[model samples]
Target: MTSLNLLLWIVLGIALQVGLFLGISFWQHWQSYSRLRQGLPEAAEALPAVDVPQKEAAGWSGFRRLKVARRVVEDSSGHICSFYLEAEDRQPLPSFKPGQFLTFRFDAPKADGSGSEQITRCYSLSDAPTPEHYRISIKRVPPAPGGIHPPGRSSNFFHDHIEVGTTLQVRAPSGHFYLEPGSSPIVLIAGGIGITPMLSMLNWCQAHQPGREVWFYYGVRNSRETAFAAHLGAIAAAHPNVHLRLCFSDPLAEDQAGKDFHHHGRVDVNLFRIELPLKPFHYYICGPTPMMETLVTALEDWGVPDSHIHFEAFGPASIKRRNAGAAIAGDAVAAPAGDITVTFAKSGKAAQWSPQSGSLLEFAESQGIAIDSGCRAGGCGTCQTTIRSGEVSYLQSPDCDPEPGSCLMCVCTPRTAVTLEA
Candidate 1:
């Protein structure tokens, strides 16, 4: 109420404001100093470098070059080499999903003047989950005795050179072909090597969720080429819900396993209908495309919904685009087609495409744009591109965000006038 009291209050308010400002400024300065001390320079934080690999490519570190040995070896149509991979430094290996794969990177001599170490390839994990080291079963391709690509780029590298102490750059297990947690019974249909993923799933289920009925229908050329027959029998014996069915398309007189095999010929619609109950159950199919196509048609004829059928290509990636059904349902927006422009932000190159041209990446490459790509079949996400401000149609559903904003250039088609930061 007095003049002196009002003057004192105003002075106190001014002091409080000044102290607050100084305290806030000191806090920010302390933070900056702490960050600097932690070796996170301002520019480093501003940049988008991550401390870890992308989740989809997680397990590379644990696969340090450790020597692996041939635990089991057999020759049928192809040489199946089962190697016991040891972990270096005795560190615990990362866990992997049943249907996921392991990418092995190695070095080998080339026909050129020098040896190149830049080589990588993927192989499905054949062994079940265990506390010890991982085991992978490989079949040498093309029936080559000493060919480079026979044991395969990665497989041969492992087979020919890698031994008990050979260290390898093993990546974390990453894959999308996972078993959905549902109550439906399962029909696992696989062909030859395609059975690897299904075998993983069956093992996982047997260990964790034991009661789900699973009928495994495996097709091989003959009894000799059938890998893991004994293991499949053991799994079936251990689990009541698990049923094992083997089909040998070409059986020899010596093929005793074929004599008592559940199915004698290839897995066609008639065989599936007769063997499977065809109730509202989930169907997991893998193997070559021809096998998958047969299974899909069989399931369709049995009135199974598309949602209930899940599959992944086990062999090499398909050259064609991913099956996109009739239309994409989420966004009805149409991408402007003709004369679409694509820009590669990193390369600082732009390419133009007309409706007559196939896609932006194809156009860019046709015009001599170099975009590193593998598995052009949309399975490998190596050719990912980021979308800046436009719409596009992709040949397949992407496994990862190519860039923070891009799509896979290998499979993307201009849906709307689109721009890409690849």
Candidate 2:
């Protein structure tokens, strides 16, 4: 055949193949649709729309808040707010080993039909376990993209409108920042609102056993923004073993009453190395991103071993731990890699999940399941559930696991088809 005829035949052959594929696909789709229409009865009862009502979070309580009715403006710093909340669950609040944080739920405005509920965030519980309440000092973050705030939410709302008697839904406390109880001669480094968790350790020390030599290096903008100053000062005065050092990035008027409370500039590696006691001690450090980076690097440069250093990032561990490895949560369970279904036993609801969803906790929350949780970072173990039938890829060890049979659904992304008893 001529070249033109061969080209024509080839073109026709390609067209025919494409037409055959399209016809088969269309027929298959029509058959499937017909079967679905016949097998599924006409919508006799419409599905009840998910009703996620808008909720208002009340002020904090438990060891979280002191008995005194102190409003946000009541404290000397004006940044500190104290208030009470009616117990919601009546289940005794979970105890912590000082240095853990409480995750609180806050609803945000969403234009989509999702009813404006947003992610839950955790803040360090600043009070001792005994006070029977959780206390957290928030610095009021601005709206940042890809963070808890797409617009004003959580901390911003807490600072702006949260008032006394406004009950907040709090998760159980969890953290790794607690003192080992004579872990080493203690050295705490804090910047800005980072003082909350460290303060918990300090408070516990003051009441329980007062002899451990403790030193605090707190950095803040100025005296006006410093929180828990008087109370911390009292703890320092009452316990001679406790030494407090304050640094101010911006110190107002020299030789004044408040001037004594301030340090000239930022708290750098030089200052920390010089001010800290000569003896090696357990170091608990927290603060802004830059401060953490600088201090942690400084500690390493000063020959501090990883075993001796402990720190809590201000918010999520995402920012705080840059090179930290993923925390695994469960023992090895053999299962095929595939889609898994999560059944909320209480609500009679189930949601299919994949690794991309991050954790069962996130999936359930997205599905509007009210699983109590704190420190979604896997430290607190509040959003834990039993492995009913299938298995999960728990990123954290089972020992620190919340419940023995259960897994912390936060860091646990499914590696196989799994069903959790929610």
Candidate 3:
């Protein structure tokens, strides 16, 4: 093989692969159109779309010891991995809403190496519910570019230490961001690690609501960063009603235009506008704060109603609704002229709070008071603290259902002079 011949062979191989992919895509699309022209089979009863109530999450209640039965690498970039967990006791598992998350309690080692600190974290279930196992996909949050901040502790532990047979304490799956049980059309938008829950929803739709139309848009940097590439493509090809678009913001040289990804830019409403025919679509979006805020705002600007615009935001939400119903649901905090006092009863600490000061947790941290917290977005109840008195208002709507007598310190601010059993 001469140098020129070798180059020709490589080019020919790539061309063949691209041709095969395009052929498959076109065939699947034709099959879908044929099915539509013929008409789909009637759907069965609709499942409930409501969020899982706390008490109803699992009749067993509390955390259960589950062991990792399998671990699979999801992406070529070595960033995303999935773990399949089975109850150690071999008992039956509770069913969850398609987009719910499972909470994990970790005894992470302290920085001083003196002892372990109890840390809580939440990861969304990444597959449809099964009788034997539950799966979760997680991406390792790499260290900051300049090392300004340390890498995520829980994610690192899962990647480095956790393996098949590792036992873990996991809570029942729960979250407000889930696919409602309905036959209506829906739009699923996911970015980076945010694709975890969307996977669950997509899988469930395929398994149960096979006739329903689903527009799934997943955004990644490139092919290497993409998870379940062939799997998603296969799903889309299998179901004509399920439309999948892989959007790569920065595609690699090896990535082909039609096979590797469908779009060259980020996943936004513009793509939706360009691709989808005008119709009412309930949106479920999950991604980074900037992407979430920008996409949600754009959708709203496009006349999508607040109720139709459902998004999953972990950590304190940075997005705010432009609609008049923007205020988070809760009793009005009676803050007298932006003047409020919050006291940590356990620590005998009191501090003044203002909108400029931030959330109760942040305000407390600034005042040198420490509170145990996880997810910081109110998805995990680690920051739930007993409110001895006074009212608190959530700066953003929480995905976790609020407690009757407590507040998630990470998301809420004191409305008046409040004391908490932190």
Candidate 4:
């Protein structure tokens, strides 16, 4: 054969091979596209429709009027009551993130026939998210030892009067401190009634992320004050990934170490330092002011990243420290340059504001002005009051947003000459 003819034959053979390869590749690509297109309908159906109106949806955009579905007296060492609430229309409930709270509005009748008084209180959801109902566990708070203030009006009202068939007006679930479960290890710390939110997180983890490692450290006065002992015990027994540590500051004689309580002291960061791995982990804390203050400061001193530490203060949002020099998270206030006057229009009282007074609520109390408050940390809107004249700033942004013209006195400081209708 001639040299040119041989070269032409080799080039033709190469072209044919290339064409075969391209055809095979195109066939495989087309097969994949066909399979994906076939499954598109199922995938689209599984996703929630965004354009559909949510009128029949379980969650509400604003305050919803719900009826008390049931009231169960949970067996506890303290006077804790659980109320199961369902939508008055018997609609499905919206799912909430674990550790969120529901704000309630109550119009309790006054004794002196001076008309009804409006009170707002917030309670953490005590159970996992369900489509049927929401549960809240409330502890009856008695008067302080000094008898300076009255007993918890909202809690006492729930325990005394709220029953099945009663209607309650509640806002949607909202809060900043919540669990975002992942493969990362988590440590949950609770004190007293703070266990309500933690229980929600624990139950969610058990149901959704059973393999995730969870360390729950709960602290209480003693067995007599501990709530959900049997429920916690049962959970610990069933889940191997969960490590339950019960810390009783003062255990009774009948309380055993292995069975009744896991530790006999307070649940502090020091206890966590010894028990948990010194690695990147999320730490969620909720409890009394002192406990939260101690744990947050200790964790910061121990070099834990601030983003990793999440906490919520239980009552009045003020975390008091034994040593005044120590700083507490979510309580840092910017001191004003000079003395500012705060006037309570309804009470007809005025006071010189000082940063040392802590919060506007504290200053009002010092001036002998009666102002209602709950969960002083700004998570609850109980301390919300109308800011009629002046601007105020929050030490930390509130988890539950207040009304447009109002501010949370518990965490707010006056920015100018302020006038409030409280």
Candidate 5:
């Protein structure tokens, strides 16, 4: 029991303790590495490759011609149809963010045996993104009650003429309205055919972020008019985090509450206020003009920040503010002083532009000058025309930026006496 013996014993004990600690750390590291190795295959299969380049080129380039793969009747009444389109060359298509749209150009045959005229339209992508194909659901828009004007040229053409194997030219998917996958609770509000994009967002969230909470509120006229009922029901049943609410403004006698629809009457802020928590939630809405305007105003009044509320109006950009008159029409620019002359170079038609005409496209149409136009809110770029001379101004910045020296006639007005190659 001398000092040297004591020192030797202490050194031996310290070495043993260090060895034990290192052994435990090595075992823990081995366990984590083993678990990660086991999960590697599944993770690789679930997510896209990070190191390899994207199969389909990166960034939006231009239109790609695609062929119609198939068509499916989504509703019992045959009013709504879903078109599945695939790349004509059978190559992988570029991926898109959920809630984007596909712009299509159609050479619709004239009723007479004269010839075909070019028509353009934009439809929201209805399904989640996949490399193989894209899907768009379109509602057939019949002519007005009196049959005065012709039926919706593009929609009816798609419903009646387009078939499987038909080749169609479609621009790559593009849109400002898209879902940003995040931890924020999502509230999707859709009306009638506007549910297409919502369906895309819903399916994407369910597949990619299954744990995210989602609440979907959809409105239609009646049970018979309800499109994708079965599909929506299946989604709600599968995803426990999703809350589905359907409102029928005019439910038929057979339409039963809690079975066919969750509520009766049009969807308004009152329903949302009652059902949804007042906490921060990202709201994405798309619908008819009136419904979009009403909900946007109501949500703002409910103390929701402008940044949290996102919306897209289908067809023309005609959402007027609730109770607000000419001063604050959605996407409407004020008329410039003096009469601006708009000369169509191709048609050789000159018209004095008025504020009532709304847009240059509208002015040309009123003059009986045929100009192919689509998504008149300026998202599609279908009505982009060369401005030969003079200036034009936009009511609001277009979602799709036009090429230099050209203007989207659908949302622009003559800033001065303008000559356009239309």
Candidate 6:
């Protein structure tokens, strides 16, 4: 045969080998996929875990006893800590929504040395949910330097008193601020301890919707105050779809640029505009009140819809939803202008609900009428009161729902002559 014939034969042999290799690979993949579709146990290891909707934490009003499995300090400042909690009963666990919070009931010591009193506080879940455990990151709120204000009771107690092996009462996770697994790109902005819920949401997004684009903007004062820096960096390094931008307003001189963080200054809507082309991206924000307010307003002014910007607030509901040009502070229903009659049916006290007043709970307190309240942002349902008559408008959506005839007084304002059984 000629030289050209020999070369042609060699090329044919290479083509045959390539075809055979591809055929075998395709067959193996098809077999593995078939096994997975058939729900075969042997193929489970070959694929990612399927994302299933989490079961509801029914009877959430009741508390579950959880034992602290581990407690680790997160940041170099030693003010932030994470606790790993496991079921004391060792029963199977259900996953929770990414942004949900756990209500903790503690028998904390009374400030006046009057023994311990049961107090309830809510803290967001800080990690992805699993059948085995839940994690929460907390920052210790220090007292004022000259003792003008007392230290945070629950936060300090958890840091200084609670430790591994301690059994504590925790209500099942529940909150309206949550993300459903979706293929759409999302932006998450967090500041300080507000990073807890955002962390949970980010982990869920990565695990369940790995292909979705995610932009995480985290801001803190300095490296010392930043938690989960290594973990977040590792995640960004591993996942191409995840873009992490860390901003430190006051980085130490030793902290290197491009190594410790990506940006300098606080997180705001301007950061989004500077870095990315505008898209219909859903924004999840959890941060200090000022940051939350500024971002919400700026994004709205940038023409983002109210439906796209999501955030959660604790304590008083200070963030107002601004849709259209109407500056309605109390939700979709226009609250009656001027003064309205508000009566505490239980206390038999009549008070006027003025437009300048806050929530019904706040107005009640101003009137020296007592009402049991917790998680003043309206998540705990502790201040839900039965509406005897008339209507009320919510300043913001409450995480917890009240009975059909009742309303969460902590977040609602009287829309008309209202009588509340507080």
Tens digit of per-residue lDDT, candidate 4, span 118-148: 8788899999888899999999989889988
Residue-level lDDT of model 6, residues 1-422, one tens digit each, is 99999999999999999999999999877775554334233332332544425667553457888999999899999999999999888765667888999888888897678999777788999998888899999899898999999998888999989989999988888887877444445789998888999999888877777766789999898899899989999999999879999999998998887989888888977788888643456788898889888898998887665666788875674876666324332243645679999988889899788978888888999999878777888887778889999889876767777788999988888988988886
**Reference-based lDDT, residue 192, model 2:** 84
Task: Tell how far residue 1 is off in model 6, in angstroms.
Answer: 48
Off by over 4 Å in 4: 1-58, 109-116, 145-149, 319-333, 343-350, 365-375, 380-390, 403-406, 419-422
Residue lDDT tens for model 3, 1-422: 89999999999999999999999999867765554333332233253343322344553457878999999999998888899999898777788888889999978886557988898999999998787899998889877999888888888889988989999998778777788645657899999989988988888887777777889999989999999888898999998988999999999999998988999999987888789854446789988888998998998787666767788875566677786354344443333457688889999988878888878888889988888889998888888889999988876666666679898888888877999997
Q: What's model 1's TM-score?
A: 0.69
Give candidate 2 regions above 4 Å deviation. 1-77, 83-94, 106-115, 143-151, 254-259, 316-422
How many residue pairs clash per model?
Answer: 29, 21, 0, 3, 0, 0
Arranged by TM-score with the best first, the candidates are 3, 6, 5, 4, 1, 2
lDDT of each: 0.64, 0.62, 0.81, 0.79, 0.81, 0.81
lDDT of 6 at 47: 26
Q: Supply candidate 3's per-residue lDDT for 320.
A: 71
TM-score of each: 0.69, 0.58, 0.84, 0.77, 0.79, 0.83
- Clashing residue pairs, candidate 3? none
By TM-score, who's the top model here? Answer: 3
Query: Comparing 1 and 4 by lDDT, which wins?
Result: 4
Q: What local lDDT does model 3 show for residue 415?
A: 75
lDDT score at residue 339, model 2, on the 0-100 scale = 64
Worst 10 residues of 6 by lDDT: 38-47
**On a 0 to 1 TM-score scale, where does candidate 5 land against the true structure?**
0.79
